[model samples]
Target: MSRSAGRSARSEDSAPSDPDARSNGPRIGSDISSNFPDGGQASAGGASLDRAGAKDAPAATIASDSRSNPRNSDPRDILLDALRAALDAVGGYRSVHRRLMQEASIEGPCAAFAVGKASAFMMAGALDALGDRIEKGLVITRHGYAAEVIEPGWPVEVVESSHPLPDASSIEAGRALIDFLRRLPPRTTLLAMISGGASALVERLAAGFGAEDLARVNRYLLGSGYPIGTINRVRKRISLIKAGRLANFIASQEVLNLLISDVPGDDPKVIGSGLLIPHTAADIDTGEIDLPPWLTTMARSAPDLPPAKTMDSIRSEIIARPADARAAAAACLRKAGFDIIEHPEILQGDAVEAGSRIGRMIALAAPATVHLWVGETTVRLPPHPGRGGRCQSLALAAAREIAGKTGAYLLAAGTDGSDGPGEVAGALVDAGSIDRGQSAAPGSCPDRSLRAADAGTWLEACGDLVRTGPTGTNVMDLIIALRARSPASTERSFHAG
Candidate 1:
């Protein structure tokens, strides 16, 4: 990938660097090893966060007690370092880089198509690896991502699409895709490279809910603060194809799908709405639920089929997942000598309830210095406008109870390097973050008394955002890293096991 597109620096253009009350940390130099300790699973790198009155290290920043060399044993620093490693671990570029066609390479890929924010570079790398075999490539991606592939003969079907929301372009892409599938040879081998935003890239408006209806419904959901799963559930009902019907086309041909999972849990049925795989046979009865007036009206008056059909012949391999990022991060932390407790990667439930549970768990379980969780959950939005993503919303909910306890760090970042429609993947919720937010934004910061929507705005105000410019791969998210007052330090605390 081009260095120009690399996560050069955090965008403080949205927010300026704070001047006062910042740590006196010295800037760390470059030359940090981009390689990971693992032989070769994921790509790796390092980064630092924003702080006032402190020198920013493009490599890694630590609040320097000694001005010369700054490598504090602070848990926050370790967690942040681990976070950087985790992001690096799941990169999609190295995958492309590794697949280059060397002199000894005998053959190239039969077919390939890479899409989404990271599609250009990744796809280019794939083509470079496969060389001439990368004929008839289908790249239905956003505008900027199309730059990665410039091969003259390779058919690069470019399409401008939206993310975190679907639009008319998505419908057009969907139609084009259907046409392409229909025109492809019956025996032609296909390599469909799918990633996040594909659903919006090439999408068909679900039965009754056209782009206008979808736009309106999305607007209402954001305003209402509904969970993503509920929205998807309702969505599954209206589309003719989603829920796996797209894969149904090449039922007789072979499709080796290389998917970059962007949805929570990395569910194929969720990523790009399962263009090549069906999680289950689409059943309309399961999607029925109390919906908005417009949606309810549409649901009552629409066809039951999704826009596409399910194909059984497309085989897939998930090259990236939440586990890859989580495990890599844990390895980095252990290298830094932190006692960590590994958590499951399948957490689910209502957003507020999940937040409360995580808070209580952190406050009570005083055993490990860090806790890690790597699964996706549903937010179930309501009927009001708010200002944050799932991670922010969760952070605010957890902060209501975990505030000011000291030493607790919570990172909720999506594997896709994006969270909702915003640039931020997630946020870090420390003991100081809550009170700090209250102080930073006063009544503006969301407290336990929030109306759900306020939490979004609070995250934006306090500079708690953790943004990873398109990391390439999608694999749910990780709620990893735990920092709190150590139980070993407290002699007779009730929280100590």
Candidate 2:
């Protein structure tokens, strides 16, 4: 069967007047603009927009009857609310809309290609903003992330594929994307919506490389615990589409690249492996990257190409980033009367170590304090590692530090909603998390699980896992730690809800 068998293509004219009225396929026509009043300037601790564009009550307000008793509310609720606010502040819809609105001079007959976890939502914003101007479009997103943003009758092709690792579908999506770009008529403006996960969602390998080789390289890099920047650098060395090679197909057409940065420095060249941005000699310099023998052999064996040329016609802008999400979350917590301890620097290195340090900091923090951290962490997988991502590992490590404490909780989750190999996003662990895990499985050992990189299993056994399927955005990870006013009075059990 074809990979895109069930999804039939349709023209824009066939779209229903009220998309929400349809019961088939994913619904559309959500009023996403409502979330960003005053042209994408969000209100402080304000209402967030759901995937369907419905406004949720302000997260700060969710914790209290009015605003005086946020301390009484659940830490999980507060963290989740802050996450919502952060996501809303940097949503793909708002980012794309705001950027498109700025380029009012660019006229119709535009071709849009959105690739990443946020493709569908970004495409929705493009459809709303560009309308008939967008003559053709394509969306490439991770499996299960194309939620409610694309419908049956739309002038776009939606392809869902694997993420963090490429499969056969990824290669097929790459071919389709290349064909789409090549088929565009002359003088057509191209709008590229890029975000995290594009590196794996679509790939076109260079000559002499196959799908297995691509998977092998990705697997090695991921398990090696190399930062995303390094992994992307390796990926660009062997790809035909990445590292600005996609620009070769555009034929000098004016290109607008709007990106939602998932990298530490918000570098368009590293985000999504720089699909439309050229790589410098230093960018591909792997001498300092400490590549393994097999990877070095693979890199050396791959055919070399000429240096990538810089394009003047293409204009790129970072619409959203990790800093934006962190700021949004901090603002919400501050409005809820929590003393914020914001960490502006990016958190890196081992997940377990980071968690241990964060746990110790939370233990010593003042009452009613909320410590917020935003950055990506890495986990070095064993020969046969167990289930769990970096976030889960961090949460479990922290659980050990606060196993029997009171009035303290920590939430570690990926903003993209899915973490590692599981559907669950991350975990929310409290003082009793370790005990709950021990109670759920009497014979099981938390230490063993943590060492084996199976924190998801322990967290699940303890009912502390946080599952938010495909949050429609990718802005690295968010870690929130809360310390209550009275430790003696705040001994509460773990609540996953």
Candidate 3:
């Protein structure tokens, strides 16, 4: 694979020099109306919450026209508000601080290790709540996501690595994690802040496995279109640190896991491939998933790891989840006078198919209703795929379904502010998105892009891509749709223009 393949466009160089500057974070609620091809509609902004002050801050302010012309408001603005609300509910700084403060027994010298996309934010929170009690700290995060929240003279070490795929630095991080655990004195309280993307950010392979083998297996599973649960199950089988095996090295008296769930059921075992959580009987079974011959052989031949020691000193809690984000989003829309129709079931299965189904549903549904769906979607990549993630693919597919229809708009995005391998969070599609894309690249077909898994390229041409940088949280994916009120009822109903 090429160096640029599956890498985020936003490099660390693009990040602001002063980590303390609020502008260094995502541009939440920024006016980006000109980015869209369709004039008047604003592109969705990112989560605006200030990590340094989130503990005492209210929810990030969402830009809205509810007091002025609610009817003429942009669906993108409404979607942006919902996104902001979702982030507020699951914001790492607030959630981690609140959880730590509630634990009365958690005192004395502590060691902290925060890993994954939300590492910086979560680490900052831990530092705040524990203060001088935290004697040592480690932060393993995705590249370009390093935030300097650690105070001077602190013993905290930060390492940036790869994500959605593992690289050499991932291996280094894995070894460092084990060393960090081994060096801690017995009886020290260990605070483990685990979140989404931990699986790829750090790993200690089994004895027989090499970095190449790990990368190849991960690439295959990612392109296989399997759900995250299945992928994580396979991961646990191959890692020395995953599937609670990391517990083997802990010298601490108490292990506290504070997580921000990105999986379907919010299973800690599945989140980050269960770095400290054990696998159940169900987790051991791969179910009906048919593994490729190479993977099957590897699994059969892999050395068995010693069972993780069960300890009563360990405690785990899910501080934030997809449901929390969805509920918060629903509340924001409801406050804006739109009727809500939230899907009770999690959205799963193929991304393209889900988008088509949702697009048709929203186009035929009653007006003045905001339809909301939350869940992660999968994409089966071709031999060689193009630039895009599941959210972009879903958005483009939806654009095909709603072509020529008026007053219909949809937004599909990952809560992490990254969709697949790109820097942009996701995409927002209107009824005319297909035509706009085709016009931008004459003779281009949306179907071809979908088939090639190149929806990001086409979405960019259409001016439909939504970029939010790092969102400081990860729950799962969110989908929001709006159908305008009928002309006859326009005077009485609140609708996005």
Among these predictions, the greatest lDDT belongs to 3
Report, for every candidate in turn, its global Cα lDDT versus the true structure: 0.56, 0.72, 0.73
**lDDT digits (tens) for residues 21-44 of candidate 3:** 322111233222212111122112
- lDDT (Cα, tens digit) per residue for candidate 1, span 1-497: 22222222212442223211122222221111221112221122222222221112212222222212243345544555676666555555434434232223224335566656556545644543454565566666665444323333345566667665677776777777777777776767676677666766666654545678667766776666556566666565555456665654553356666666655556777776665665543433434456767677655453433233334456676666667778878897776545777775476665567776787777665644667877666565557755566666676677766777776667776655566655567776766667777778666646433455456567656556665544455556777647544545422332334
lDDT of 2 at 191: 91
Number of the predicted model whose TM-score against the real structure is largest? 3
Name the regions of candidate 2 deviating beyond 4 angstroms. 1-72, 216-231, 285-310, 487-497
Give the TM-score of each candidate.
0.68, 0.80, 0.81
Which residues of candidate 1, in runs, are more than 4 Å off?
A: 1-69, 95-109, 115-122, 142-155, 182-187, 205-244, 247-253, 262-267, 278-313, 364-368, 378-384, 442-445, 484-497
User: What TM-score does structure 1 among the candidates reach?
Assistant: 0.68
Model 3, position 304: C-alpha lDDT score: 52
Per-residue lDDT over 125-193 for candidate 2, one digit per residue giving the tens place of the 0 to 100 score: 676557667878999999867644565556889989887779888998898899998899878889999
